[model samples]
Structure formats: C-alpha cells, structure tokens
Target: MRCWAIIPIKGKGEGKTRLAGVLSASERDALVDAMLAHVVQAAGQAGSIERVLLVGPSRHGLDGAIPLLGDPGTGLNTALGAALDTASGGALAAIGAEGPDRVVVIAGDLPCVTALDLDLMAQVPAGTLGIAPDRHGTGTNALSLPLPDASRFIFRFGADSRALHQREAERLGLAVETICSAGLEKDVDEPADLTDAAPVFTPAR
Candidate 1:
C-alpha cells in the first residue's frame, strides 16, 4: 500500500497568471515558494506516502526540497506522461517502491492542503478514484488513483475540469469519489482567490 505524491509546478514569473495583479512580483514569487513548502511539508507528514515527486521545467532561482524531475519539453500531458513513465518503468522499481499501489497528484498552488487531506486522499478503496474539487467546484485540485495507468482522465484546467474528470471516469468504468475538503478546495490562482484565504506563510511564533 505504498503511495507517491506528484506535484507539478510552473516556475514563478510564468505561473499564477491570475494572481499577478493582487501581489507584487516579489510577493507572488514568495507566495509560490511558501505554497511549495507547505505542500512538501504535508506530503512528508502523510504516513501513507513514501515519496514525493516535483514535476516541472527547470528555471533559475527555483528551490524546492523534494526530488525534482525535469518536465518533458512539451505540454501538460507530456509532462505527466514522463512522470508516470518514471514511476512505472524502473525508477520506483529500483527503489523497491512498487508501481504506486496508490498515487496522488496535487496542484502546487494549493497552500492549504494539510496532512489530513493527504490521509483522506490515500484512504480511497482499491480500484476506485478520489478527486477533490476546486473552490469553484468546477475544477480538480486533487486526484487519487490506485494505479496511474488506470487514470486516463485528461486534465482540462480551464473551466470545467470536474465535469471532464467525471466524464472520463465514466468512460473508463472506474468508480469516482468527489470530496470538497477545505484544504483541497482553496488554491492561489486569482487575485480574489488569495484574498479569500489567509496567507499561509506566517512566521513561527
């Protein structure tokens, strides 16, 4: 029952288009760093997860603690394909971590995701998939599957990703569970989105 978490991050100055107006350039970059830190911290705490993979293209001034994988110089689909291939081919095999009995793919923008959310995502029954809807309830923020290959659901990040996931799940004949956890639903995408949630990177008291 080993699991891995895949987090795809688009480096700063290129990510979070909607938040540009709400925060200064430095603020946005700092926010991205804080979000990545929170995600890494939560993934480390999730007892169910054995490893965390950061998938994204290489860029200057990018610092993350988890192992980084160079994103394939292609679109989102190709980047994901590369990650799955790594997990399926020999990387995980060599480490004795089998082809993810469970895999959790989470958005890097979600700063509020807690260890509890990771636990819940990893608790799905075998042969089923679990997804957490975004704040608008139209997009996907978190998705968990027993096996990566079983997830043929394409990500359409624009408007109705939730609907797209449901449709794909139905097509693949896989049972799906939809959850709206507070941590999973909120992400820093738009200016209003940041305003809606408190800053996640407060100094330790």
Candidate 2:
C-alpha cells in the first residue's frame, strides 16, 4: 500500500508560543525550523512512506523535495482535512488504485521522531488505525489512518486527544492499534519539554 505522511505546521511567528518563557523569538523560530527539518527528513527516510506533504503557511526555507499544501489559516482540524482532501483527490493516485491507501498525520514538533518510528506506524494492518500518544499519554502525537474510511474520524487535537481519537475510532468501528515509541512520544511544547529534548536538538555538525 502507498503511504503519504502529512505534517501540519503553523507559521513561524504563530508557532511555539508556549515556549516563549524560555526561548526567545529567534530561538523559537530556529527550533521550529529544526524540528520541521527533522520530521521531514524522518518521513522521507521511511521506507514505507512514498510521499511527504507539508500542510502549513509557506515552504520558503524548508527542504524543496517535500511538497507543500498551503494551510487554510483555520483550525488544526480544518488544515488537516484540507491536506487529506488534497492527498485523496488525485494528488496520490497510486494509493487507492493499486491497493489500500495509508495516511499518516504527525506533529512537526516531534524532534526525536525517527524513520523506525514511522515504519512501525506504517506497519499497521489494513483497515486498522494506529495512534502514538504524546509523552504524557493524553495528547495524540501521531496517527495513521487507512483511507477513505479514515475520513470518518474527526481530528480533535487538544487535551485528552488520545482518548478522543480512540473514541472516534471505536465509533467508526475501526480497530485501534496504540503504538508506544519514545522517539515518537517526545514533543517540544513547554520550556521543560525543550529542556528534555535538548539532547536531540543539537545543531547538525
């Protein structure tokens, strides 16, 4: 099956605001850029992922190889829905044509995400949905859905999103596979999160 990974990123000025207590304006911008680069690199390196779609404001300084789907400047769910629509609407023709299509939505702030984590998420059986919750196990850090059925579940990304996603999956009668991976769980949101992620945020030598 063909797999497409969609990463939703906010504009530089609008992102990582929660970490303002520790990171300066420039530092937060750099951190967001670095994390975006790392996420894209990891998705590109995943053997199961055929394409990487960036759903965000603009792709000016990002890696040119990955495709960008301009966000509608709405909420997270709306942007994600737009990305999914684009992917399912002929952008990824091979997915449903040959076999089942897999769509993976991941947070751009997961600095520690690796190709292995992506590969594991992609390994979910056909007709099943995979979820990787955040470090605290309350928020969803990553999700894998098998389309077109994937559209049934609404994207509720916030406090207790993991439970919300699971309930949505159950409502749709889709088998839920909860995946736990340290690389996929860690996310930089607060000053403390940044401190914990510092080891992985080193500048490329």
lDDT of each: 0.74, 0.83
Q: What TM-score do all the candidates reach, one by one?
A: 0.86, 0.90
Question: How well does candidate 1 score on lDDT at residue 49?
Answer: 86
Tens-digit per-residue lDDT, 1-205, candidate 2: 8888889988877888997777677777788888888888899999999888888888638877667786788889888987777676644453433333889999988988899999998888888999999989999999999887776668889889999999988888899999999889999888778765565464232
Model 1 / residue 162 / CA error / Å: 1.0
| Residue pairs in collision within model 1 | none
Model 1 CA lDDT for position 137? 88
User: For candidate 1, lDDT tens digit of each residue in 140-169?
Assistant: 888886675454555555578788877777
